[model samples]
Target chain A: MLDGLIVSIDAMGGDDAPEIVIEGIEYFLKHEGKGRRARFLLHGDQPRLDKLLKKNPLTRERSEVCHSPTEIAMDEKPSQALRKGKGTSMWNAILAVKEGRANTVLSAGNTGALMAMSMLQLRRMHGIQRPALAANWPRPEGISVVLDVGANVEATASQLAEFAVLGDAFYRALFKKEHPSIGLLNVGTEDQKGHAVIKAAHERLAESDIGLNYKGYVEGNDISFGNTDVVVTDGFTGNVALKTAEGTAKLIGKFFNEALQGNPWSKFTTMLNSVALIKLKKRIDPRGVNGGVFLGLNGIVIKSHGGTDKVGYSNALNVAIGLAGSNFLEEIEREVERLHDEDDNIGFIE
Target chain B: MLDGLIVSIDAMGGDDAPEIVIEGIEYFLKHEGKGRRARFLLHGDQPRLDKLLKKNPLTRERSEVCHSPTEIAMDEKPSQALRKGKGTSMWNAILAVKEGRANTVLSAGNTGALMAMSMLQLRRMHGIQRPALAANWPRPEGISVVLDVGANVEATASQLAEFAVLGDAFYRALFKKEHPSIGLLNVGTEDQKGHAVIKAAHERLAESDIGLNYKGYVEGNDISFGNTDVVVTDGFTGNVALKTAEGTAKLIGKFFNEALQGNPWSKFTTMLNSVALIKLKKRIDPRGVNGGVFLGLNGIVIKSHGGTDKVGYSNALNVAIGLAGSNFLEEIEREVERLHDEDDNIGFIE
Candidate 1:
């Protein structure tokens, strides 16, 4: 157990690829201090990786390199690659998790492909109709886990309620927060509002004996304010909201850069403001919270951004390790079993 | 034509109703400087207003006070209010726009009630299937307009395309940006992705002779960035994304306030950083944006936040004045007619 857990990294998945991901891992290993308990399985071309390691040499007793000859194209359809390209890095990483060669899997590849592969290969826990992609985002009030960010856009009310339960379990295990509040994302907070499906799910959630800190309904704005700890929504809305936030931040950065470039005085001000800007960027960038754990799956699968750098990929790897090290998967099952025992359909909608 | 541009204010709407709304109007009247024009009709309890105005003075003579004996509670059911609460502040405000008593209406009241009343009274535009609530939110890059924000949760491809047109027109009129770039909000930037309706709309938009800067596809994160001038999505997703952005800003503000609450040293640092924070806040705050315009209505109908202060309500009134002043309805009609004349069905899927 002290050996911790090993996470396999698909070093070729993201935009920056192996270089930045490898550099980031090196940074962590060198700076993370002693007593950091975790091992790593970095998968990529051995020759390409050796060159990187030779230049930035570090002790790698706890890390191993796994070579994969095939690389997945970013633009290729996830389904096609999953079926036809078994030798690709993505397929190998999934295989690693299934074989128990790696405790968890982390990748910044095509999200759709990752979700599809996990669902088809790893399968879902008993009673789970659909697994969810839960994004743990830091809000001003607290952190919120927004589930189904893009896993399944259209879902039954029962699926939404199940997502809520899974999200609750995930948040509780990860954050160790007592009674994390669960909110149903809707157009309004009114009891009479929302679509037909949400209405049914709301009723089911209200009646559940799963000991959830149910907070009724919340809107998109509620997520950032930490008004609710676990925000449950259909994948369509959650995905849109998450992406819009990211786009807005990027736009803001661009505008500020242009403004600062207008004059020397502005440049000085920008320099003075760099510390605060960096802090704010760190606070808002989704990359900082790089990995979104695929909840309700048989084993842990953390999905990182496809545009991740070494820092981002390593962050994803670390998140996977942390989840595995903490026995997060076991605890989630326990919570679900407890909820199921209480009602057997605590998250089911009639 | 000048008389066809009067704005009636529901002084009873919003958190700090009447007083702040009144004060905001007074500020505009005093500071409007030159060439600014519009008449104001204040609809609320006249007795209380008379008492309040005794302490605050007005600069303009284009003011009329209409008595609304009853007030709709902020949290009251909008459906009930629309059907039953005749002669209430909200109802009178709607009547002002519908009956041509005023060219535009501005109310910081129950959003649901306002939306219900507008749809029922003003009716949808000719050949339009749905009316969308569009708001121009200030982002760090520039102003981005997001539409169908909770007016209707689900919308068809044609409806969304119509919203794109409406948003484009509004952005052009208000910001003076010629031929603004319009984006269909989706989870992925790829053409084949997104729900069936959106994919259909995307195709339609691409082929149409709509004289729009048709930027292929945008994800949610694209909203805050100047990447797209107008972002269109179904009401359910749009509303959630807008609110989530607002909530996040608020939470961030709260965090900063709490972090810098005490100690002279920290206070000094905060004061030093206050300018940046204020600038950022002004750019992100929905209240700063003030009103969400109900497009495709017969007349301008501005929906203000129920929790807004008097200043916010006044800003809502001002937004209405600007919308009317700009002859936004006429422009939209012209644009719609142009699109209709093209006889092009804008969509990818049938």
Candidate 2:
């Protein structure tokens, strides 16, 4: 289904560098049969990537290496990286998407640097004031898309409305849904709740004809309860909420593990139920969903965690490939145009 | 230690009503020895409360029922509840604190109504612009005090500083820590991160000498990781983060249960490990830390979850008694005065 799709990879970005990045590519191609139809444009140190690719025959057969001498340091500031990051691997991968050499860009680099480079290179979409970073939040029902995780610190009322439209289109493209339920993440579900920006956004979203299934307001608990398909908010609060959830999950896991290993009875029981425990761990593992998609940009950019291993890096590749195959950028463009036209009509009516 | 401390209870506030309220009192006094040192002022339907208290001799001996014919509905709006809330159990409980009949008030009712009544009856402290809701978040190391959970939707920089002082005093009073490490919650640990209000607050906190051990910025994950003794933020973000953590915990618990019940082998192992699992659950139970302390007010008020049962309500009662015995309101007043004097000095320096 993804035949001829090319994904640009920053092989020098993550902790393990070319080794894990190349292994991740091999794992994805070997485990996911549809992945065989995809091609790769790997950017990194030429000699290092060449040696790693030589070890993985399958990946070597389906990939082409682009020699990039420079690499962005994991702790480099975004402004500093942008100023001196012309030929770096992370920059090259993003540039490939802008040059039409690849459909999407995937990097496990410093988030700040990646965001800054992508914004400067790919630029924002026609009607977007700022780009949003979105993540797939796992819930009991399925998955919900939460946006503005950390791309921008603050968002205005119009910008929040824009995020709603952006998230709606992104979900529709990925899930093939005609209409996905959308919600503005707030402190409370009531109309009178939240601050002035959120209240104004709620009023605008409710009145606007953006073809969105806007479900007024949703609280923090509602995000994981699967109350809506897309939860949109300003980046600061969304980032805090996302990290808090991740931390809480980790804390609970730590508690569970300690409890199981504390005594002889628990140890024996854990050994007996190792299969079930493994299944549960795999189901909730953060590595399985380790990608933050950059929205409201002209090109697709998926950010993998900087410290993630092969399994996590592969998941990021899968996310990028799936989004590229779906032509997500085209969907966003159409949605943005439709919303603009609707707004103009509403102005005339008023 | 409670001695002659009196805690006013809203007997008709929660979903289970006077029965659970009276039962919770009994459970606390029975399980926690320190609970018996305190007295109770029950506000509710006099005949119903009288009949329930009659069944528990210990509770009957220490409690005095105040006839309150009306009760605040769980879904009543704040404005509506305030206009016609006179003589209602929730209102009477707060009034008892204002009238100096009780050291503190505990309510398991509509959060909006309770907040409105508390603000109307108790009023904000002399130098405090807004009151904050603080909760004891249990972590692996210990409990961290997180404030501004849902009292004010938006907080100014000055108000955030006020919350820091309030939370500092609160932690000191309850935990007897003369100087608790405090952190301002934000998207990142970097000083330059977050919005204008947060940035301003961070600068003010760093410069001002209100006897606070300000630990700079902390991210969402820090709250459960026990990075600081107190984590402060605007109520909107704080509420979202709190609920998100709760929702994530519930989701993980559900996943664990489903995985255990999937097969006979797993079920057998789960049965064998039931003791360890129960112990873990008890240790992390949300009910054990059920109350949200209303800080920055002239008097102390605690809000319990409306849907909680006897165990949860008992935990809330314990929290109320703890604060009452510690003289939390007076501590807050003292802290506010010190912060004001320090602010005046800083203004002169600038």
Candidate 3:
């Protein structure tokens, strides 16, 4: 019954709504979406989307619009979003996946609203107490995934264990790695380092026979080291760390510009090295890593940065298409069941 | 009677000890410590200290070596250090402050051991639950201070409130800013964004008017914005954020280096911009900003990086001399008492 990989999109969500969304799809179909059977179910005001789609021929050829009368505010509270936000573009975007009309959902909307609506409609996968937002973190060489970036403020030991299983499957499904290493983010690498919750989660990960590449504990530096494929932590710590890294990257970029443009001679020399500088700029470009995949949900949901441009949104769409085309959801279901089975066996053995 | 600001130094603590310590003192005496009545009591093997001190004319003239037979290892456990670490150079360094022989203590030793011995010797000030380690965080313009970087794993609401007071006095003394704005670090700026602990701290700081500048909440990005002078969080989150920023800075530096060396033209251009690059290097140099100060203790104890060079150690020595001369302790005591009085009045009003 499924006709190719369908991506449900909230076209009216981000700062520059239907414009960026339509142009982003067009950009992706030309760049990253070539030769792929990626179809989009755009959810937004039909009048505005039609106008934008007329301007974007590639997106017009590959997508169908679903009329949505309302759009959630960017700064709306989650509870308020769920109360009066049904039938809205953001809500219907997730509803399409819940109704099995779409393979995955992608939204550049309010993260809290997207998370809230996803939980209300699709619900958590079997044995998943909490759904988490796993982000694509740029490492020293390649990319790694860090989970619970900002979905839940806190997580129990078992939930952290489930995150590992989910994140492991995520990395494996995306990169096709067989045994990607997992590291629990802690204050120190020692067994007796962080809070009681962290220690408990560490113990469960260490003792469980979940068959994961469970490396012991890791410090904050390990997140950027690239040796570890998956980094796990509660949402509070993960959110702060993510933003801190982002702020640091921006500050360094500013410092780099200042370094190159101090004087006329310096500026001229910097212009001469523009080719290499452009190459470096592409490598550390934030657009390359823009999507945050919502794991542990029954259906796939990817949240893009709310204030991103067309290029960043297109990168997120590239991720959504790649994940939609794969067996990512099925892989997670199998891993989650195996993790719970290990827990049950441990409970009985004890 | 105390003649001048006598600084007790753990000369045998760091990776390259006695050498860096002696050289660092000489460097500080010539630079930041010029015309300051700062005397040093170096604690280590006397023969080694004597040899190193003799090689450095200024340090030899200003410092007296205190004989200590043992030195704590770089990676020793706090409990083990507490039990068997007595009479060691680190322990004796704190002892000099406890006995009023020195105004402050400085060490480039194991952080856990330094914290443990300082607590055993100086103990916490009145109305203070746990001591906190405050580090200087470089902002976009000026510098800000973040507390509980690695002192305690968790902090209660009242402890977080107390950190505002301690960090406030710390900022004022170090920067001569009379009333610096304080911000509590959280996942988001919303009241309902983070864990209950964070919410409670927010409420406590919001309601209580201890006549301090307490801005409600800030995210990780705010730390580098330089708008807020003091950022407060638990040790777990603070430690992770600090290290995460450091790692990001280093990674960016690596990327910049790789960017400039891609081809012959880039190499020549980069060589031409060497003067500007050197200016950039000095502006963001980690050596200029070194040292972690232990607040809420009866005496001042500064922790320098264990693997830092003489330049880094000298910056830390500069902090030690500055704090030793101020009434930083008295300011915290007065603010803490006023905070408790406000709590009592609130209880009565209710």
Number of the predicted model whose DockQ against the real structure is largest: 2
Q: Enumerate residue pairs that collide in model 3.
A: none
Cα error, candidate 1, residue A30 (Å): 3.3
> Candidate 1 chain A: worst 10 consecutive residues by lDDT?
A341-350
Model 1 ranges off by over 4 Å: A1-3, A31-33, A55-59, A251-287, A309-311, A331-350, B1-4, B210-213, B256-266, B269-287, B309-314, B334-350
- Candidate 2, residues B59-110, lDDT tens digits: the string is 8888899999899898888998999879999999999999999999999988
Better of 1 and 2 by TM-score: 2
Q: Write the per-residue lDDT of candidate 1 for residues A107-167, one digit (tens) a residue.
A: 7777777777777778998777789898978776457899889887677887887788888
Clashes of 2: 0
Ranking by TM-score: 3, 2, 1
Tell me the spans in candidate 3 whose CA falls farther than 4 Å from its real position.
A1-3, A348-350, B1-3, B348-350
Report the lDDT tens digits of candidate 2 across residue range A128-237. 88899998888888788999999999999878888988899888877778789999998888778889899888888898875789989998988887669999999999
Q: After superposition, how far is residue A81 of candidate 2 from its true place, in Å?
A: 0.6
Residue A29 displacement in candidate 1 (angstroms): 2.6
**Chain A TM-score, cand. 2:** 0.96
